[model samples]
Target chain A: MPSSSSVPFDYSADGFAVRDDVTSIHRVSWEKIARAGSHWTGPQRVEIARQARAARAARNDPPWSRDALPGAEGRLPETAVEAARTIGADAHRIDRAWAESMIEALGDAAYVELGSIVVTVSALDAFGEALGRGHEPLPDAIEDGTPDGARLDAATDIGAYIPMADPFPGPNVGRALSLVPEANTLFFSNVMAMYGGPSGSFFDLKWDGPLSRPQAELLAARVSALNECFY
Target chain B: MPAGEQIVGFGEAVVRGSEDLPAAREALRQALGEAGFLEACGIAGIFNGLVRNADFSGIPLDDAALHSSEDFRDKLGLNDFSGAKNSDLSRADASQAGEGLFPHKGQ
Candidate 1:
């Protein structure tokens, strides 16, 4: 992990332009969150306002301890919310323990734990197919199946899982486990390749990383660049 | 790093879907750029895919013994709107009016 003293992150001139755009988007989102004032206290929203910049300063892969704060008697993971930033952290990471704690924090707040099925079977071949190479850590065994499609949010054109439906556990995890929820967990297990784990070690300081308002902005920009997301 | 370890909670939320869809989507656009927007949708679409499987497998709604949140479940639209209700469907109107046709998708 880079020491807290590392004052600069070498984003070249081009990187600056990209960073600026990401920042502007976050600003807009935070502003919106503040105005909304739902599911969070005004002070809570202020903390979320800091997530984008803090996550960025940590290079988008911040550690857990520095990233989360206690809420409602439990340490809620970064809300990482957008839409004007007063409610939750727009961009942040949540560990498994943290994931559990987040769900735990909900405390009868209308949340569901989607269960995840862990196929202890060898995933080396699967990883090879995904990356065309044999890697030590492999992706989980999850795929888009027929039955899974039936559950799409059909009633609404939005066709997305509603946030109100959130804090949902991994289908394969605990009570949330169903065959398809299991597959969903496997999918979550697989996409880590794109998010930068080992490659992002410099920032995954766990609890030792930066978690302040400015760091959130920096994290948001780095991810926006990597994902090429410009909303 | 474990695959689960990489995405973090929101990372999975990226695929599993976010606490707030449009806002999260918009936020991705801010952080990730246009592709990020698409990625959020793609990630979320996968979760939508699960709804059928979950309902089919006779998957029971999570028992309180597990994860519990009254506000989380029933209030699906609240979190995304920052607690505002999504009773209005302007996007649907535009689509029905054949307006812009999935502004997120490429022309």
Candidate 2:
């Protein structure tokens, strides 16, 4: 079998009408996430993430979407969950074993690590955008070295792939993704990155062994598929 | 995942399960696509972790109420924290206090 990249050859340009189906899925996922729990911030925020993950396990679908979720109505969506049904979420990506392994590797402590990753990635994104527009990075969105702490390093080594929008473009920060049509012609590029990205990890994977390029992509694909992320 | 168990349950229902499991599940598939359910579940998980970790240690309600919530105190420029007092052991049991964290002290 080809790497994880070898598989998941669906959602092509002509088929989907856009290149970045993956990115679009990610964008929609975030939007739904933001809207799903607008009031939450801080520690409770972490719990919300956990619930989603557990739910994903319970709702196991064939081709995991990672972004998809069953709406208040129940079934998965025929199209994109965000545009039509606000609460609609899809299926999960990996087998129960993978989920269990992930949980085992990173527990609540992973949440803390994820919190930093989310903020760091977002901050880095803002900083990257600002720099892209040619300006000094703002205080509101700096990596603060905190982003590059031990937790992040450990995460990066594992191959979870959790990149953030850094303040200033650097060796670590590459071209960040955005679903805004004006910017990325590829709608689901983010999903693509998340699903089967070749670049180094955005977040670190706790488990480590010998993983081929396809394996990495497949893992990400498993997650995206599980999320039910349709752009 | 919202702090209160009620809200958390509500969220769990919507994201994880659904009000009507069969119909809701189907609709979720059609609307969000295959990843819709999975994504929602993952989102829920992501949010659960994001919120839990951020507030797990619990910021002082007073400080939390304020607009600013610096990771660390003004005095200490570190994100790490140290609790001042121990939780009163007289609190309710796990079943009684409800599995959730208390209003203050010892989450």
Interface RMSD for each candidate model?
16.8, 18.5
* TM-score, predicted candidate 1 vs. hidden true structure: 0.23
**Cα RMSD, each candidate:** 20.9, 21.0
Candidate 2 lDDT tens digits, A57-164: 433344345444444232212221221111111211222233234335434233233333232222222212211211111112111122211222222211122222
Q: Worst lDDT window (10 residues) for model 1 chain A?
A: A116-125
Interface RMSD of 2: 18.5
After superposition, the stretches of candidate 1 with alpha carbons farther than 4 Å from their true spots are A1-28, A60-96, A106-231, B1-107
Lowest summed-lDDT stretch of 10 residues in model 2 chain A?
A130-139
lDDT of 1 by residue, A65-128 (tens): 4444223222124332221121112211222233334445532111122111111111111111
In order, how many clashes per candidate?
76, 134
Candidate 2 lands at a TM-score of 0.22
Which structure among the candidates has the greatest TM-score? 1
Cα error of candidate 2 at position B43, Å: 6.1
CAPRI quality of model 2 = incorrect
List TM-scores of chain B, every candidate.
Answer: 0.32, 0.34
